[model samples]
Target: MAEPVLAAELRQEAPIPLDLGFALHPGEVTALFGASGAGKTTVLRCLAGLYRPRTGRIRCGGETWFDSDADLWLPSHRRRIGLVFQDYALFPHMTAEANVAAALGHLPRAQRAARARALLALVHLQDFASRRPAELSGGQRQRVAVARALAREPEVLLLDEPFSALDRAVRVALYAEIEALRARLACPIVLVTHDFEEVARLADRVLVLEDGRIIAEGDVGAISARADLPIIAAAAEAGSVLDATLVETLAARRLSVLDTAAGRLVAPVIDAAPGARLRVRIPARDVILADRAPEGLSVHNALAGTVAAVEPRAGGLADLLVAVGAARLRAQVTEDAVSRLGLAPGRPVVALVKSVAVTRPGA
Candidate 1:
């Protein structure tokens, strides 16, 4: 494995106990997800030098950004970190180009304008360079903020709920734009979001936090498969994220077939071509459990599997971890259904999933 580009261990005294450590690698988008007071943003701020922890150490590309024992701390302006805030903090008086140029103030005055325009163009805001913050749309303003952040060519990018203010369609479009931007930048990106769907679509790795501590950390697929995480077990929208390769496109049926470890599954038509790998999220609520080989059903996908574990969840529901040929899937069934079907560990069963319910995240 490659060494992490950003590494930190942070601790705090009050308001919510903070004792957590994590690392971010280059060319990777790591998401911080949790409840409001779970210390997700705290970690981001700590890394950006906005919030200094009582005792901790932070390193970026082998350079020390903070070390409590050594009495070393880099100020926010000194730290080569780019931050995009939830509120698009653009200067109303300055045009989009000027805002981006502001970040390159350290450079020579004559070179700043060209660098600013280049950064704006990089974020697809070339034409909007002269527009003020008020004249631009929410998504456009956010893009300008992103360009400003990149103007410094920071070692790490910090995004704190940057898209929460936008509508779903705008957010989705920006997600695609950010993905394209990631391909051009080599720095590690840290995103703080409460939306699991956003995490599924954009994050390569996930960190689940609770009570100011990181309870689980892994790739999106593994982390979303975890039954122990409260967010997965308790949320009605809980689901397992799967990484599958597109094998075929059925234009007649308007569906796309993906090859997963469990089996071949068909979903609504995806925009990508065959042989492309993408993330699919199967909502637990949409999954149906069958005790016998299901026959005559409208569902398009059914995979034979064994029940690995079952746990009673909040709201009188139960979460099942089903193992299907080395791939684990989660199904949310009722306690009544579990008892009537005699569901338990080591029991043979089948998992039925609706084609429409299978979400092609970030599509």
Candidate 2:
């Protein structure tokens, strides 16, 4: 394994004013996640030898690519990196194959074409080699761009919104394609995108940025584990979020488990051995409350919890926060239901959840 294509700490002012830090290790995907002006693209450009950070050291695969203190900077073309821009940056006058072949600078024309053909084939575009950029769809053009980047056998791969120019379905499918490529290529990979969904789908580790400096950094679970208060208040959904440990298989073979905060509870059986992680957020509106524990009900898991707080919602619906030991939950229910159930702060009630509501990733 080699070091990252570039490793450096950047200090900048603009979209966000401050010193920002990041590192890209070989064989790992690092995502610069932020909003429109969060400086994600700026960071990518700096790593690609485009934007020069006033104070930082950058190296590519153990080779010094850029050193600000040493007054040594390499041009983007000399960096031996594959950069896929948001627009694909294909030469419209040339066919897809030519655009890819152009990256093989010193190779003979025929050898370059063969290298281009193989790279294009890797991206599933062998037949489209002759197609000009104008003749290709957005997705096809992006694939051509990827093929061109790989043509150099880059020591590092940098992508800026590679999927943003395509349709949703195409973006998702292409992401999987890129993920497959990532596994096969041993180079360091860096992607810049504001779309958290993209990060969730593709990133092994996510770095959250706000106001230029990194506010959070960790795997998906760590970032999402924070109470939705700040993010939820921003997202506009009311739900009690819980992280559970998978317990065991039930007789019915439906998913059974212990709620993160509440004690033992079972839902429909899930396909997992003991000790799998599940993240579930139960919406407040789904929970039905009764003064006395309901008996002989269809709901499998009912836990007693006290009302934590009440939040006013649209259309006379109330968002209730219930506390089960340390487990906090948000449920959306009608004010009438709140009144009928005699629910208030500190009132005891049962929280009902279906097994299917538990969300799982392909772990």
lDDT of each: 0.87, 0.73
RMSD of each: 1.9, 5.6
> Residue 28, candidate 2: how far off, in angstroms?
2.1
Candidate 1 least-lDDT 10 residues = 354-363
Of candidate 2, the 10-residue stretch with the lowest lDDT total is 227-236
- Evaluated at residue 361, the lDDT of candidate 1 is 40
Q: Name every residue pair that clashes in candidate 2.
A: 240-330, 254-268, 254-269, 255-268, 255-269, 255-270, 284-331, 284-332, 285-331, 285-332
Find the candidate with the highest lDDT and give its number: 1
Error of 2 at 70 (Å): 1.2
